[model samples]
Target: MISGVTLLDYRERYSTKVYFQKRFFTVYIPFLFWSIFILFYSLILGRISISDLSFASIIDGIINSKFLSFYWFFMPLFAIYLSIPIISLIPKNKRKTIFEYIIGVFFVFNSFLPLVFNLLKIPYNSSLYIPVLGGYIIWIFIGYYLDRFDLNNKSRKIIYILGILGLLLQIVGTWFFSYQNGYVDQMFKGYNNLPSWLYSSAFFLFIKENYHKLNFKGILSKLISLCEKETFGVYLIQYYLMEFFILVLHFDPYSISYRLGASVLIFFLSVFIVKILHKIPIIQKLC
Candidate 1:
């Protein structure tokens, strides 16, 4: 197999010199930038807002709220994107496949579950903490599968077909189950829209396989490269900044379009901030 901008190989993790693998950088970078606007808009507009206080209410509200329902969906994907690099930091001896690293990340976050369960005064499922952590677990694995398309062409074709079929089945199943009430009351609602997991999974798999074969090393590639490199800083500040903006704009988050716009604005802002902070000795850790 051809070496893709050799960095810290899984077999030889944590080398003296740090380098980004070409496999991940180009695709991840552009996707991250695109996600900011897409996810934010969905959050603010796609689903209804989480009512808090009850796990049931949040799930229900998310299903009802256009933007809020979408927010729950984003949690799984974006959280995973945020965590990949951190997981890569683990020693090679201790780590195995990217899936193992993802589990480790989940366990690290899951460690806090006992505390969250005890401290939070709410009904069952009121504690939505574990799911967010689980989201990280899901994405990193997706990245691994994406970066290394070892699967044969036939296998990939089959997988894509199955993913689509599974989603279609899921839609039918959910629709049937949802008739119990006037509406479905779970954050895990809707389908055939932007950021569809089944479609994204298929697309990522397809890209991973053909990425090297494609023309990705040009100006557009460099632009994406920057986003991938700056993503950690972007992740660190995005949600915090989003919250801040919510207060500043005095705008209710239920507006999906505004939140989407804010996410796009924040994506560029994060890159500029990272450039400045890289100069500072101490603040680097915060980003």
Candidate 2:
């Protein structure tokens, strides 16, 4: 939704070059800085040694760090920002065709192609040029297309019903996959899975349709303002915060009580950490 709004503004008010350039500086530059921070944090903890710290190692950390696993999202985000201009070029009339094409490509590359390759014992890179062609591409396109119009009452009702049904399917599908595998299976947890894709689309549509009805005042409004501004930073760092809670404090992995307590602690800690980071003049950009 945010991307769609930004893209619409770019199309109406800014030159393509300016839009792309701003994204590179605003998005990629911060990502690069935080990625470096993650790498150095790993090194400080002896996750890697001086012998492992070659120029290639640094490049690899920037490209592929095992310790900072959440950084994996950055590659796709960078790719998406770069591709936005081209994606936005499709004529309004042709959007439906483009949306359908993207959905078809997702199924072909993410679902069907993988099955074919595995059965044939073929090897391939699964990242698919990072975010540009990954499973989340469908959601990106769907959000963009949905942002172009206001859904009617009937359409909203349909989407809401589908959303609930999809959520149920997602839960059941995850359990089924886990049972079949005799372990926890993440096939349904990802954005690319059919159940997740459907659920996410419907949920977003429901939100977009009803967003106007939500009213926040006083403390709620203030909290929302802070979250809207700082959620991206929170996202970038929350994984590490949770890890810290688990590793340092020894939060019980199996106890629901411990998990709930740790989650709340992690969230508030993350908010405080980001707030402090944002106060630093130089680090503010990265935050």
Candidate 3:
């Protein structure tokens, strides 16, 4: 929603090409620089030798390897940004209909296509397509639509009810699916799931409704403002920060308390690191 608001305002103030170009630079340049840093850092740390640093290997690390597991987020986000110009050219009245159809198709693909492939014994690779067609794209359109149109009170209440139900569905479905799959991981609760779609819609609506009620002032407000500013940096660096606690400090991954504490520690550490990084001119753009 925030991105939607900002992009819409930019569209009003600037040419479409200029806005698209600026948005591309702000995100992609940072991503490319970060990926390059990862490659060099791996070389320096002896994780990869000159022979292993082939063009294909470097590209795979940036695009698919577990060394940069979190970078998958950047790929779909970039795809969404790339689609903005095309979506903008779409007629306003037709956008919701088109988005609904696309999301519905992809949602089914994410949730059921794998099962169908398994049943048919077809060798299908989800990784090849899920990032581009997954349900996260639905939320991007939702954000844009919500920014463009307000929900009526009745609609909000209905969404709130559905959200609660969705949360329940997610919790129950996780347990059920885990048992059926003979694994403990809640893989069914992926970002592309129906439960996530419902829950996220509800959660966002709840926040939107309640946001103005809370008096955000003094230290609390300032802290929130800082977090908002540092969020992209936190996202960029958080995987490594969290991993340090697990790898170096040897925090037990199975312990909820340890994981929670590590998260809190990483959050503050990431914020501080981002603050310092922000002071530098070129690096500032990435953070």
For each candidate, C-alpha RMSD in Å? Answer: 12.9, 4.2, 4.2
TM-score of candidate 2 relative to the true fold: 0.81
Cα lDDT listed for each candidate: 0.51, 0.71, 0.71
Return the lDDT, model 1, position 169. Answer: 50
Over 204-264, each residue of candidate 2 has an lDDT whose tens digit, in order, gives 7766665656544455456677676677788788988777767887877678966778777
Q: Flag regions of model 3 displaced more than 4 Å.
A: 91-135, 185-187, 216-220
Model 1 lDDT vs. the true structure? 0.51
Q: How high is the lDDT of residue 173 in model 3?
A: 68
What value of lDDT does candidate 3 attain over all alpha carbons?
0.71
lDDT of 1 by residue, 70-139 (tens): 2344444444434545655766555446455544444344433333343363333535445544533544
Q: Where's the lowest-lDDT run of ten residues in candidate 3? A: 1-10
